[model samples]
Target: MSNNVLFDVPGPRARRTSRIASIVTSVVIVGGLFYLYLALEAPRVTANGTETPGMFDPTRWDVITDGRMWNAILVRGLLLGTLKMAAVAAVFALLIGVIFSFARTARSKWIRIPAAVLLDFFRGMPVLLLMLFILLIIGPGAYWAGVAGLAIYNGAVIGEALRSGIQSLPKGQRESGLAIGLTPVQTRLIVEFPQAFRQMLPIIIAQLVVLLKDTSLAYIIAYPELLNIGLRQLPTTYGNRYFFTFFFIVLIVYLTVNLLLSWVARIVARRTASGRKTRRTGPTAGKDEKVGVDTAAMNAVMPDSS
Candidate 1:
């Protein structure tokens, strides 16, 4: 007897059909993967005329055993190149997002309308095209071009998210702040904005993870980020036969970073929920003391009337 209005609860026969569908889907997926594995493992003729499955070849994967290879791919490419760019871009994006959010939410139509238009423009533009446009103006500095492009586009998206979070808040939040002698700007900055940011924090972090992955787009602009270094330079240095090995490593690193970010978001959401609960229950803690003091003060002021 669920009250959910979205759909009817499954009956016994429906449940059986759902379970059968699930099993069939799982088996099809497993079968497809196994077929893919066998296809990759099949023997093929190399450019040098030797027949072997590249996926199973030891020579292709031997580069992983080299310390220099790891140093080049992991240390230089991942840490210095990709992570550095992502860190700088993340900071800039956050700042721009806050500014854009405030502008978009401003009471003045002059500020809000233009801000909305600009945000829409950036949001609609492709990240790669933005990077290329920036590259043309910046001239020969792919890193800055990529950073600027990522910041601008993601800033607009984050701004919209924050705006949505702010709008979703009860109207009383704004009214209360204004009733307490705060100006509109003060009410937004000191009260509304912080709550909105906290409410939208998990979404913001998830957007940042998307930004991190988008750093790979810098490759098209000739920035020496992780993908360029691992997919291009490392393969050339280690021989093209090891290309898939480098690609596999890069794939794993991306997955690991994105997963860690998602985990952090979950932890933040949990903590935020717990903090709100604490605040909800906290006022009762000092209720008796407050009542006792009020009673004593009232008695003192009443004098001989008692």
Candidate 2:
């Protein structure tokens, strides 16, 4: 026998609404971009002004195919430098996140207060301003400047994520571990920290995305990232190709990176879920199992031997 219930299946109202919203947003964005393109192209030049090779030359992408302005000066300086800076910043941010996470969870103020203030100070500053300030002191290399800015800002955000996730764990979880004779360090290492990390991972991924985008700001300090390449090319060749160039850069840097990271994250989530299910069902490896004899004893001892 089986027990079940039936109800009317809802029509695809929600799906239809989502489709409508997607269509409307796409229409608006494409229309607005087309309008902006026509508007910009209308009067970009000073009439008979000497076009830089790639600026407003209209020479059929001569600048892009050639890469003259960018290759002339800032090829590796910006393209490769931006990548290195972003990588360094991510490393520093992760390191600072872990350090600050421990600080927030540690037992004493000597750990938390100063760390909190430093974290707060970094997070409070605007990323652009931070980059500018660091660039002045570090003097225009995209590597250190972008890294210093991202480390301070992204690290602060990540630290907060870790701290909040740790705090969000049930208080009883920590106390129970301690009651079993685990020291604060041992309890956090064995139990609370793992749960906290799993919860905070999505947030950390989000911050990494932000940091990667912020790397675009490297051009402001004259570090010559992808945007810098576009900017340098625009003066002479594709001055009016602003929309296309900028959006191309966005698609390349932001969209591609986020999509790839999201895919990897999904895989990780599926693996984690499988591991958790396995742990829940499988008995502890070292536990003693009382099987056939134990079952027979219970049956034999039933009331009235029945």
Q: Write the per-residue lDDT of candidate 1 for residues 43-83, one digit (tens) a residue.
A: 78879998865575777787888999888878888898899
Candidate number of the best lDDT: 1
Backbone clash pairs for candidate 1 read: none
- Tell me the tens digit of each residue's lDDT in model 2 across 1-306: 332245344359966886899999999999999887666445344468954343233553444555564463245534475566778899999888878888876889898898888877877778888988878876756568778888888887787777776776667778999999999898988888777777566557657767777888777877766666554645445555444544454456556666787677667657655664665467652234211112232222121110
For residue 252, model 2's alpha carbon misses the true position, in angstroms, by: 4.0
Q: Which stretches of candidate 1 lie over 4 Å from their true place?
A: 1-29, 46-49, 273-306
Each candidate: how many clashes? 0, 10
Query: Please, what is the TM-score per model?
Result: 0.81, 0.65
Model 2: weakest 10-residue lDDT segment is 297-306
lDDT of 1 at 273: 67
Candidate 2: give the clashing pairs: 52-236, 54-236, 54-237, 54-238, 55-236, 55-237, 55-238, 55-239, 56-237, 78-224
> lDDT, candidate 1, residue 237?
85
